[model samples]
Target: MTKPGRTLLKVQGLTKRFGGLVAVNNMTFDVHEHEVLGLIGPNGSGKTTTMNLISGAFPPSDGSITMNGQRLSGLAAHQIARRGVSRTFQLVRVLPGLSLVDNVVAGAAFGYRKRWGAEAEQFARGLLERIGLGDHMHLPVGSLTYIDQKRLELARALAGEPEVLLLDEWLAGLNPTELQEGIDLIAELRREGRTIILVEHVMDAIRSLCDRCVVMNSGAKIAEGTPRDVLSDPEVIRAYLGDE
Candidate 1:
């Protein structure tokens, strides 16, 4: 059995309802320090809702969220961000008219220490370079391709210098080469000791990056184990991979 280290994030009986629909139901899991946790399931399986709940995109209807032993359930998104959590959204959002670097600078303004002026731009620029957006820094964000826009979202999130990073389908639109580049970038973050929760459909990235994975179905956790184990389970196979 793999031993878990210090708990970085904890969710107990987490549930969210949008009117009559229970989008997430009693989901419970813990993310450990310096480990990548994969949250995977088929489309509409509540993966993104889980990320939103953890990142404070909105309040949960029920359950508790704790980080480093402190309650985080009722905090606003930015307040939660201040507590060392940063996340990339399922839909990449960037200011269309802003220069590429400026979009990241906006994130630095709200994330943690609140960097400003040239210092913020310099820091944001460095992150843009790390995420492979350096050459396009002066261009309007709308000019970038879909894959590059995703990288910009990641750069913005990293500007926060977060301890725990939650990524929701941030690798959606990449080709094979760009996919490998993203996988390498995530590996580097893991090497730097950042705890990550990755919600992705790409099995290759999950296998390469996650030490363990949690499988969800219909808003409930169906299995939890090493990537090989969970992916091979009969239920996981049935729910996801069909009868193959």
Candidate 2:
């Protein structure tokens, strides 16, 4: 088992309301350094909403978010990103017009430590190579197949050198083979001790990659613990499968 390090990110009493509808309600969780924490739940459970709040896509209506004990809730998206938080969207997003290398270079130049010029290019290339996109570095992002596009997005996210990485349903649309490949790539990241908050429905990936899991439903956390314990909890089962 991988023992978690100190708490790197903390989400406390986080809530978001779109008018009368609550997207995330009083949600709280901690992500430890060098640990992969799975945020798993049924559809519309606010998993992605929680991720957005942490990554600064949207501010919380109530509560706070902190990283390394520093407040992050009020910062803008770019500001939060520069503070060592990076994320991939539930929908894959890339600069389609840019070449693979340039797209990743953008991430390197703007994110975290902020590399530039040839250094940024070199760093981007190395990340692409690590993600298996090196051979296609010069290709336009739109030209790659769907799975490869997903790979490119990951490389870009990693180029930022984030202390905390958030992945929202990253394995959603893959075929079995592609899913396995994706799982393997994530597992490799875990071995390197990356701190990741993964919002996923894939049970196999959740079981294999997560050090702990926080399960939610209707925008509120319902269970949290090791994957084995939470997945078997009666409340969690009821949330996913409903009352019999």
lDDT of 1 at 167: 93
lDDT of 2 by residue, 1-244 (tens): 4789999989999999999999999998888999999999999999999999898899899999999999999889999999999899889999988889888999998899899999999999999999888899878777898889899999889989999999998998999999999999999999998999999999999999999999999999999999999999999999989999
Instruction: Extract clashing residue pairs from model 2.
Output: none
Give the Å shift of residue 242 in candidate 1. Answer: 4.5
Show model 2 residue runs off by greater than 4 Å. none
For model 1, the superposed segments whose C-alpha errors exceed 4 Å read 1-4, 242-244
lDDT of 1 by residue, 71-163 (tens): 889899999998888999888987787888888888888887789999999999899988788898877777788888888888889888887
Residue 37 displacement (Å), model 2: 0.3
RMSD of every candidate to native, in Å, equals: 2.0, 0.7
lDDT of 2: 0.93
